[model samples]
Target: MRTPADFCADKDALLVPAVRIVVRIVGVEQQKQGDAHVLGATEPELKCGPGVDNDGYFDADTPLGPYYLAPDAAIRLLTYDEKAQRMGLTDPVPVATLRDVLKACKSGKQPGTPYTCSGGFFHAAMDTKGVITELTEIFQS
Candidate 1:
């Protein structure tokens, strides 16, 4: 239920203009370990403001921090990474390290997206490193 005005949180300190990026982070137990899931599960989320300081996650210019997009929101995938480099999209361009990717995928089982009165659904199990590496070839080809 976060209105557009609500998403106006500050990015860390990248000193870039405010660029909007809808971010999704997977947690271990469906529930965030600490302040992780501040934006609830199912509903679309407003920008939560700056992310944890370069915690091996998305590499955005701290200023235009990443925000949560409510789970129910139908977001189209943006392929502007190559186009939006200076604007602050390419930061996440680097492939997640094998360790970080593994840990993040493990967090997926927790199903961070919020649900209605019923609660939530678990989108556990995403592609593993082996799978991703194999899939990466498609992009290479």
Candidate 2:
């Protein structure tokens, strides 16, 4: 298996489902502002996963390949698309409740992580457990 300490640098690390679950859970209680906020493990940005604002870190092992620490100001679902553009969905709606978001990430089907690439499109089913597992591997060891 791959550990977080095994990671290197200058590479695109993919976020896993399990990792997302853990971070999302811990992030909720963490700070929710500034760079250090998301990576603090108490910010809600944990749900941001690995791409946006990339704000999460881990000191683990990963002989599989290299990886870069996300950051500390990652964004979340509701924070991503403020104008829902998927599935005929128009207006901004905070559909993800704290309880459900946690349950889904743990269930292995997160379904969304918040992305406003288009400023109006909302893509669901964006799980991050994969990356979560990678960054959080050391804690287990």
Whose TM-score is greatest here? 2
* CA RMSD of all predictions: 16.9, 14.9
Residue-by-residue lDDT tens digits, candidate 1, 51-127? 53322122222222122322222221112133433111111222222123324335553212121111111111112
Model 2 lDDT at residue 106: 47
Cα lDDT tens digits for candidate 2, 97-118: 3324444544566335542111
- State model 1's lDDT: 0.23
TM-score of 2: 0.20
Model 1 bad stretches (over 4 Å)? 1-19, 22-24, 28-67, 75-104, 107-141
